[model samples]
Target chain A: MSTAERTAVTATRTRGLRRILRPRARLWLGTLAAALILFVVAPAALSGYQFGLLAQFLCYAMVAVGIGLAWGQGGMLTLGQGLFFGIGGYAMAMHLQLDDAGPGGVPAFMSLYGSGTVPAWWEPFRDPWITIGTIILLPAALAALLGYAIFARRVRGAYFAILSQALVAAFAILLIGQQASTGGSTGLSNFRGFFGYSLADPLNQRLLFFLAAGTLIGMVLLVRLLMRSRYGELLVATRDQEMRVRFLGYNPALVKTVAFVVSSVFAAVGGALFVPIAGIISPSDVAVVPSIMFVAGVAIGGRATLLGPVLGSLALSWVGAQLQDNYPSVWSYFQGALFVLVLGFLPQGFATLGGVLRRRKGDSR
Target chain B: MTTTRPLALEVTGLRVEFDGFVAVRDVDLTVPAGELRFLIGPNGAGKTTVIDALTGLVRGTGTARFDGHELLGRPVHRLVRAGIGRTFQTASVFEGHTVLQNLDIAAGLHRRPTTLLRRRRGVPEEVLRALDTVGLDDLADRPAGELAHGQKQWLEIGMLLVQDARLLLLDEPVAGMSGEERAATGELLRRISRDRTVVVVEHDMEFLRNYADTVTVMHRGSILAEGGVDEVQSDPRVIEVYLGAPLDAPTATATARATGRETR
Candidate 1:
């Protein structure tokens, strides 16, 4: 054969061979690559400060996963994920502060800022097991109740978004108003340890980062299963044709409630982890702004895709940090411009890049 | 088309009102098992309201029984579980999903919650069979939104087929169809009614004359007449209501009244 023809024949053979791996195999391979970067490359490459910042972004990414499910798939448009995040964050923070206080003593901030006596509500969090359990269950229960109420009334779209935003605002203001129990506006912070591990130790900090990374990956896998499962189809179906789904013998409200609760639980778990990693739990984190930021991250990532929220969160955070360091005065405007560009030009976000490239190629041909 | 053991539906004193204005008033309807019944009426006739009551989409005062289960006062999904289903004027398929996925979701009425979590296994025989029944097997993998108008309607009927919905209430299934599409839809409905009971709310007079086994004419939210095609068509009252002409007056005078002036 001529050399050009021979090379073309070999290329065709290799392409056919590679197609044998299939989508399922490709997914597993992609996941392995991500895990390697997160667990090994990230730790080996970055300074401790930058590494900690990445860990913080992962927590936000976790929140984005739940937002993707509830808002992206279920069409909920929840603007108050920070409320659930705060619930979990405060739950963990209370326990950490109580543990540091030793036995029945009050946290230093509480004694300094408010009444010396610990409130009755703060007592249950003193037990680490109860704290952990509450961290998981409280947000889910609240979400279930709140989701049922709103969805049952068929309140959605901008109204649901507005209500969720109002809720986070109220929650933040409530924390600020309560001086004695919640440390007023300053909120909860300065944990000496995490479940008996010294935060001062570099080894423990790395371990916490790993925990956050593993949790984020686990959540992505879980939501993957949900999206592939019948429940996932039903969730998307519910989003599109809620009334029709009702006539299909599925309770649309119940279907929606499950998505809402699951998403809220994810946010809560992210919040719970945030306490140990970021060493703070304040109203500032749980207010309306951070919750909206969670949404922006997911939207920029391609909300419906499995890993879009994670990648989106990481990318947005990295860029935001770089801009803040360099531009300082106009960093916020750059971020706003980024949101407009992504949401306007690429409504489905970065996940559609492959499809766009393929389409362009097809058009050329 | 696969044959299903259709359920019978009976309603008595079924009344529906929107804020003190009665849309459907004390109406009585009985559709026997495996009968293809057509409900025809004018603009304000409330033929669709009766369906709304039956499907639990609206609150009605009286009882609507499907087979042995009570339909009224129950949630819509519960009524669906009780073997009742309906299609809408506007297409309601999950437009993003493939044709096969749409049917699979409908056929999964009996699936357990835990089973819903796992990825769907191999396609069930029922789903594959429904695909062929609706003649959408070729487009099984195509997104539902991509289907043409008639094809979308057929896919909807296919969904009800696998849902195993015994009593099917179709609203304007051929609203925007060409003659050819109408004939195909008519043929499909005929095949469906061989086993399953069907109530179709329609406005196309030609489609009705061709396909209706029994027709119930409704006027002003009440049953005006009920019988075979020719019987209702010949009734003077029916002709008068449809043409808006006075039966007792002379033809010339009736024409004059139409223009609001005396012809004589």
Candidate 2:
């Protein structure tokens, strides 16, 4: 074939490929396009401070995605996700604090508040890799253990909710009590660097924002894949009728445990990233209020849909930040009213709001 | 179908007590493979409890075995994996799923190590076949929650059919079915009995009379009589318990006639 003819054939082939990328492929492509705009384009457009705020919202969005999976799909009502998130944040914060401290040195907080010596528990976190590993494993292990014990005994519904909330309360108390190791109620902050990238640099901060956005996109994609699988069907089935699932030869407890563990790991990863992005880890962050706020964001977004929780959380948190800045006194009240309105009117969340409107229109017709 | 067939389910001295109120008491029952046996009694007679004990849905102090496997202490899932499938008194289905998806979940139940990442797109032939059997193949894409009560019952039974369960314990399978649906269900149960052990706990006397090969009558949590449907109906003790009159009373024949004409 001649060069001109070959070039024409190649162009047609590319056009064919583009045409084939319709519907499902188009959905993924759209998501990718949106992600690029958000993580890359938006970062480029926004100031450093605005980008950092966006990154912080992304961290909460990460937690909301996990809540959507567990509470929305699995029917777990996991109000204590902050427990996992806080644990992950603390793990990362401790490692950064240790890194800021020179070798053969304890974290500055330990010297100031604690005895001059480093606690035995804090020693392992000095290794950045260990800290990262702990952030993933610890919360996952706790969720798995708790899920097994509760689900095996068939403790569910409101009881399970209460038990998980109690665990968060207890975790917050434990962290607060361990002043020397945990830096007490004020939590850990004032990080000098992240993996040797200086936090003092605006470029590095922007990079951190990109990293968070990238992780959120990856986690959302992973959850989307899971929701389309047989396991996802089984999880929903278990939620609807556990005894029926057992009669079909599935251990519902095991299915629920898997969902709980996956959600916890997501929260943990979110928490770990939160440390560098938010630059703080404290008892107040991991308490019941934050845990419930995580649920509220999911509820506002629509619990069952893939992107609802992420978008809902980001929007709510951003609005909250704005509210705090402009109307600090009434912002919380506004937040409560918005949540109430969403619950009363759009129980399926904003994700299904379009469907609800369409249905009402259809009824009129 | 034959006396020579090995027993598929065997129970001895089976008893279930809930908070010291004896629900099932010292029941001794044996069912051979490939037989359609019906357990019938009035309300609160522990007919369902015996099934609960056999399927490990409720703890019972007795020996219950299915195909030589001890089932008394085993969990519900193990019993299911060992080829015992049960339907609830109130039809319990994955209501949010389409008819095909419900069957798919059932058909895929025995698959080992359900993968975490892969999407399950294909429906198993067994699920398709079961849907066809229950005549729900035409409506396979409709959500089960939207199905009529009778259809939901059929879907659940179809779920058991997809599992290829060796032993089926159906609790009130025709509770809310219309007469036509009940007749179809009777035909389906007869078909299922051709190659499997079926123990149906029902209050529908006419259905048992038309379809059951053997009938076990329960009264006050124990077997009152056990035999062919005609024999159990004629058994003097069964007549008294069912008719609320002595077997030799003047009202006995009238009561028998009334019961014979009753459908449910």
Candidate 3:
């Protein structure tokens, strides 16, 4: 055949295949199927301890998705999501402790701190529904307010990043100082039940694992949907060129603020789930170190690509857990080395591998 | 064709300083509705500074009234909302979006409601009409960054057209166009100026000669001459400051002899 005829045939076949496959739908379906299998089927096969670890990793992955949206896409470089995460975790932790203590009983931490009475601020957390709802909404509302104050004045880039980091530092310090109610450096732990269900029971543990897995899948789908919408286009535009987006009549500050808040809420939900699965809440989990770990996973996964952050976080957390268990002395250094290697060699993250393969295929065709 | 209404843009004693260096100094100008005016000068003559000040991109101490609203301290987006649209010297089309999406964003500003539940109509027919006017309707689906230089320039103009601003500020609208593209741009401007006011900053003399009803000349951050194109071209101060000293002896004589004509 002539070159023209061959080209025409190739084009026809490509179009026919595109029509039959519907690339976007296929991707969605494939992702959903994979997540279902990973959450439902894989956990069933693993030991109880392994399932619990997966549950913890899923929570971390949820936070990673939020970081991907805020720092990766919106270019906010937020290093303080841990503050919001801790807020949700502590809120839920307080409620869980109260439920374990029974009516009119003080938490064990309050007794150790000095006062035999629960603080007035901790009163609202007694309601399970309120605590659960606050875990989702409180951090988002606070983020919205903070984002509006900073971004509206056009504070961005490194200055915004430093400000967010400072907030996290202050939060950790505050938690450390509050020995009575907050559990200080050690943090609140040794919970017995959540909403009247015994935490020690194997069934409750499995249920919490499923909840975390379901929550992770749901959060990923929500982000995917948002990123595919027109608002997502506006968000990317705002990130690329705020001046141009402004000239196009969009208030870039407002758009960025909304995205930041939504991301914060996602992180908060992850943190809330994290406490129940891990059976503990501590300053170590919501400190600057963990915040950096959150960003490292996103960078290693490819910040712009969907599913990269989730998978990257899961893989990195799994490795971290394993190395710490097997070689406790060098695990931290090893994780740091991994970040350095990824940054030095694969700055676009592992997602670019797929793009390269596709390009090669196109060239051959 | 003068109306009782004042000009769309009236600037008097406009002065803009950047770190104590005056970019636009004591310049006065006016552009009437339905008229195409050009501000022409050599490089560093403050043409773009004037555009920036008018668009509120730069702060200026001047009396700039557009449809009777003060523009000196207002923000750029607010200026656009007040019926003043502008295109940048370097084309400002969104690189990641399609040409149609860029225009839709420009037009979408006027269509936003108080709530998010409202359905936003995609690229109205008027936007398509604007693209057709600039001969870029077929390239609507293409990413804007992939378009040719001249086509991107036209697309920027199309964005301004779809904005439907009462007063349009176009900075170097035909800066990188070919001969055909430049002529097409001139035609497009002429067609657009029938229902709106236009203030264009251009360095292309031929383009100014073809389209400008009035030409404002600037030198050293101030208006040196304002009149018809021929009047500004013949102004001695403008020629001396902008066109440079007359080519003496060998150069002039050589050009005259080559063309078989007397030196001016």
Candidate 4:
């Protein structure tokens, strides 16, 4: 064989070796191991109520992970993810309502407040399969459309943030206005079962929590795989130097849209699961303030690190619950203070704490 | 020194307006493939503006044809896919990525159906060749943000190469470089131009005279002179544009010295 051919073979082999040796590969393995421990091993020790709380927290962490990808990595600050979250939650809630009603019967709420007629739009969700499909598709479709229009028009940065927040506000107002069909400000709740699994049973509740945990882990794994791909690098490139990415023959709009839509899907899935696990879906749960809180959790944890958003969201929610229990009025002040402190000092998030400590150790040596 | 190579870029009557102010006015230029052309002019003479217009970074009226295809309303990325590549005046690159990663991203430009889901092949042979061409193979793992200014410039050029760009539009590629860095860049530019058309917007007259096969001088948003470097240098209009006031022997030499690295 020619020397050139030999060199090419060597180059490809070395690249393969390099791919394995990269720090990201190690991190991926570590995350997988940790996920197993958290999802499979740790659940055995927790009480049913604690496990349910954990599942709900994981759902929030799921949304936070999406925030990290788009806001931290892709440089898209999606402040109104609650809109997609609401969409997913409502989709799930509507299906649950239909299932409990059992063929041609109006949901209990419709008889109570809504006119005794099921809305035409809610008809297709009667089938459990469509409900499951809509849980994934509805938010993805909306996000794709919104992302395409906004990104192609180059609406980004603070303007994009305001627009997204405005969308959430408008969505909440619309839900309120459609009180009869939507359950109004009260929102949809009182789900009886999930695909025939009785919610009243503690064992069934545990099963739901397991499903949420398993789905969250799967989503994280999917994100990890994507971040290692060529498209991941392009996403980061688009974030850092969009004009240069354009000159390199890439459509920045398409790349950003993909990231935004993926983020929306994650939020949608989180919201869908939250409905069953939390036993409710209300307008208040998906308002603009909740959307901002979602971003807050991501920012506090570390938007760029894979584990940061998950851990940060879990920690923030847990602490917020504790604070609300102990001193409800001061909880908001504490949350605001924490956000300010983190943004001011650890702008990269708490994930960088390890790196900072390591650097300091190196400096001393 | 002219060969029968086809024209890679043809622009005529191009004008760029920003609000009410015209940045580039009624410009006409053509570059044959496999040629190294220098665009030199005074500050704000619309050298970069013309490059922007051609690459579709700025909206302009007129005709720009690349390889027999009209290129007027196309987006920047489409122009890049159509074989027109560009580098910025300030050496724009993915600063967060490593040298190898930068090249890898550039090589993935032609990947289809979007970059999501499909994992692009890792560091193609072309990227390796580009890294070697720019003499940055050894520093492949180093973050690009930490590279020296000249190294960043070379990396950006390597990016264009890996994109298989047929027409390279470089704006002030060697600006702010040390003497040694400038010499190396000039050599690199000359070597890369052997297989593609390269248009460099520069301010250094001596470098143009030394390396440019053809030089086009812009004055007040229009082409003032175009020819072999020596011919354009000797042209009265070109000399007058350079000196601005009038062409006395001392003033001309002073202007040349002020532009830096004057050859004669």
Which is the leading candidate under lDDT?
1
The reply for model 2, stretches above 4 Å from the true place, is A1-23, B1-7, B244-264
Given the true complex, what DockQ would model 1 score?
Answer: 0.77
True contacts kept of 4: 0.83
Preferred candidate (TM-score higher): 2 or 4: 2
lDDT of 4 by residue, A101-219 (tens): 88876899888886799989999999889998998988888999999899989899999999999999999999988988999999999999888888889888878877877878777
lDDT for model 1 comes to 0.87
Per-residue alpha-carbon lDDT of candidate 2 for residues A164-282, written as tens digits (9 for 90 to 100)? 99999999999999988898899999998999999988888888888888889888888887788888888899889988998898889999999999999999999999988888999
Candidates 2 and 3 compared: the better one by TM-score is: 2
Give one digit per residue, the lDDT tens place, for model 1 in A1-365.
98545655655565575688886886788789879999999999999999999999989899999998988889988889999999999999999999999999899987787778898999999899999999999999999999999898888889999999999999999999997888778889899989999998999999999999999989988888899899999999999999988889988888999999999999999999998999998999999989998998888988888878878888998899888988899988988998999989789887665555545556777
* Comparison by lDDT, 1 against 3, better one: 1
TM-score of 3: 0.89
DockQ, Cα level, model 2: 0.66
Q: What's the best-to-worst order under lDDT?
A: 1, 2, 4, 3
User: Per-residue lDDT of B149-255 in model 4, one digit per residue for the tens?
Assistant: 99999999999999988888999998889989898899999998987889999887666767899999898899999998777776667667777533234545564
The full ranking of all candidates by DockQ, starting with the best, is 1, 2, 4, 3
Clashing pairs in 3: none
Per-residue lDDT of candidate 3, residues A265-312 (tens digit): 888898888898899988899989888788788888888777888888
TM-score of each model's B chain? 0.90, 0.89, 0.87, 0.89
| Stretch of 10 with least lDDT, candidate 1 chain B | B244-253
Which one wins by TM-score: 1 or 4? 1
Clashing pairs in 2: none
